[model samples]
Target: MSAHSPSELELERRAYRARQSRRSVLVAIASSIAFALVVWVTVINTSGWAGVQQAFFDPAIAWDALPRVWEGFLLNLQVLGLSVVTVAIVALLIALLRTLQGPVFLPLRALAAAYTDIFRGLPFIIVLYLVGFGLPTLADERIPVIYLGTIAVTLTYSAYVSEVIRAGIESVHPSQWLAARALGLGYGQTLRRIVLPQAFRRITPPLMNDFVAMQKDVGLISILGATDAVLAARIESAQTYNFTPYIVAGILFILLAIPTIRLTDWYTARLRRREQTGALL
Candidate 1:
């Protein structure tokens, strides 16, 4: 059998689509350059630009601060890694508790609901302070601040992540659970083997967004005297009376978050396209 080549009309359509794509790309690039140029002009024309640049954007100061900030950033990364694992475990348990469907489980469900509600409404910094300061006193032990910070982050984020997970679980079709049950699968088995896998797929983008947020917030551990990047930057800033070290820490955090942020966006768009078109890719 001979393969059929594209028809002339099909070829023309492909060529036109290619041209349109190229035009779109070129237009995007041009618009970006124009916007950047306008921003540069506006900022440089301001009377305080020179002082602001010296205070916040001094390259020499950034270089001077980099070693301490980098060392401290490693601690932030450690806390973030620990917090991610703890948050996932705690959030899943809470989500499961919230999803339980029985009068016998009413108390558990209510407790979980109250936990999420309170934590979600509370500011994370306040939680950090409470956990960082209060927990050590209660234990009557000299606990490390890094551990306290990680615990605080896990508690606050678990509330948010649990809601996202619960939403994903609820978004799963009820019929799937019924079908699993009909197949003689227990409730836990149905959730673990059938429902949760699908829910996780649906919720991955939001989970990643949360992870990116955690990366930035982990820097806040410095408030507890863990000497994480933010604290190191502050110490340097105080010594030099320049804010450049803070900018350096901020930039490092932005760099840390960029990959996860982009991944979340890409996954979101891919999920949207699959939902709209019924395409697996």
Candidate 2:
């Protein structure tokens, strides 16, 4: 019997073409709809656009709140950057602890699990309030609200990130561990040199997704009076009695979020390609 059949090859080619056509049509429709919506919004919000234009071009209004907005943006970036870095480090530690197996590891694992469960199960707003407002009152010390908010976010996000790291580590094949052991690597050495590296690559997509989520979660800090981008816009709107500032803030958020989203998609696609290549190999 021949390995290739003409009719089967033709069917496979036709199926591939059909799938490509469907994807192309979906993309076209989505693009068209998005474009149309943007046009419609621009047309309907002409007055708001005019306000924003005037505010930007008019030196008085532009200069008045611009500095405050920039300051708030810087503060937001600081909070976001600090929280993410702290969470990543702490999560890694917790994940490591959780993965260890022994009687002595039980208490440590229980503590890590409790931390994750408590934070992941609670509402972010409640956590923010507790950390920002409630803690200071209890401790009788005046902690900066911004610092409190940052800590709260860090704690909450670290729990979720720990789970990601734990899952990533577990996904590394047992054969890889055995191979590392055969190479005379100890448990810690095997994990650090082989298992962790592979797991890190495997979890990059999920980690990036968490980053995107954290970026938006930064907005929640505003509820704690952290004066982040959202709070800045709200304050500006309240003082000026105009909605343009809020609209501007929303646009800025979309600007920030869209790029992160694109990067996430790119990373996910790259990971999938790597997986496919590995499978083929």
Candidate 3:
């Protein structure tokens, strides 16, 4: 075979990769369709198929529920937005505190550790209930449900996020910290400019996964009557005596979450590609 120019080789490699990618995608889709057909056949052959359709798949009910449920979902979007900021700030601070190097910080480290352990070990529902309903008993006036739900989400996710962030920080070689210190950077400066950015990049996938979970868990806040989509669905179901609205609400959430999940996967894949390119060069 004749030798190829660099540009020709690059073009050939790209074309080969594109063909392989298309083949893989076609195979995946074919497998999914086959699997889905099998499941559909099995389901329709079951004795309860008609009942299931009536209860869960009524097209008219789904259509009717869409508008109301969507309105409630807007509230969920707001909660998710606020909670992301709240969780990220609190979790990063907790992670940093846990990573402190001094004996004087022992107490703060212990406190942060305890906080994470307690919150992580608690059932999410319990935390939501305690924050949403139980706290108001001690106060003279009712706390706004939105704030309470946001607090509950923040407390729960921060514990998890802080631990993920801590892992990312610990994954970085200690030599980097030593080098930063040797360069006369203070602890705060080293962390701010060097450590955290790398740590956060490492934790991006897990953090995004948590945010997806948070997107759904905020549905639990509907239990406090905050009138989010799930709550709206529940109310509509109560009035109509059908469960299809809940299914509609669930479908909406899945649709909303798919984009985030895809984005996270893409970013993680892009990072891997970049790392491989660097390694190869």
Candidate 4:
């Protein structure tokens, strides 16, 4: 190969370095602006520097309501786990029905669509109330409001998850199904062995996103009289006649949300890399 001219090579190298330098400067400026804005808002809204100092050193509120807050946190975790598991199972069934194509499937698809649309359109509080109060009257028996809240979360979230799963399944290539059928695999065998595994991998990021969304929705259970973290905080605040319990609860929610956020980001990045490598191959 012929060697490049010195001037041309130097110009290309300088251009590459300039692009990297510009990106670095842009990132730094953005970070600085964001940090300054956050500080300005915090100072302005929180009674200046003195209030910020007091907030950091405030142990009085935390010490008093820690027990109640802990209990509420545990309850929140329980509801989240139960609701997420229930929703996942329901979502998978809905996804299967959605993928089928026939006159038989039309009514099933319509029902799934209605389920998704109604719950997604309704406010979480309304669903909570309907389940909590409406069910008891209809059944003529007192259902525990907490269990009702779990059902509400599961029903609403499963609708959303079903759509996610259906999209994931549809993204798989038709050739995979053709190949499986050529090998004498039945519909169920092809779906189980060849389709769902790939779909699950593709759907992992959205599933993680749904999970994080569900974590926040756990607070909605509190509206139905479930003693979730938010409700616990409110009760503690009422008893102590202090705003600190609410602040404590907010911090706890942030703490809980952070791990889910991190996990989602990590899984998304990993999947993206795998997808890119697969594409290149």
Q: What is the C-alpha lDDT of each candidate?
A: 0.94, 0.82, 0.91, 0.84
lDDT of 1: 0.94
Worst 10 residues of 3 by lDDT: 272-281
Candidate 2 local Cα displacement, residue 138, angstroms: 4.1
Better of 3 and 4 by lDDT: 3
Ranking by TM-score: 1, 3, 4, 2
Question: Where does candidate 3 clash, by residue pair?
Answer: none
Q: Residue by residue across 70-131, what tens digits does model 4's lDDT show?
A: 78878888888789789989999988988897897799888888888898788877878888
Better of 3 and 4 by TM-score: 3
> Which stretch of 10 consecutive residues in model 4 shows the poorest summed lDDT?
49-58
lDDT of 1 by residue, 1-281 (tens): 99999999999999999999999999999999999999888997788999999999999999999999999999999999899899999999999999999899999999999999999999999999999999999999999877898899999999999999999999999999999999999999999999999999999998998898889889888888898899999999999999999999999999999989888999999888878895554
Highest lDDT among the candidates is held by which one? 1
Separate clash counts for every candidate = 0, 0, 0, 0
Model 2 worst lDDT run, 10 consecutive residues: 54-63
Q: Compare the candidates by TM-score and give the number of the best one.
A: 1
Residues 4-105 of candidate 3 have per-residue lDDT tens digits of 657988999999999999999999999999999999889987889999999988999889989999999888888888899999899989998999888999
- At residue 193, candidate 1 shows an lDDT of 98
In model 4, what lDDT does residue 231 have?
Answer: 89
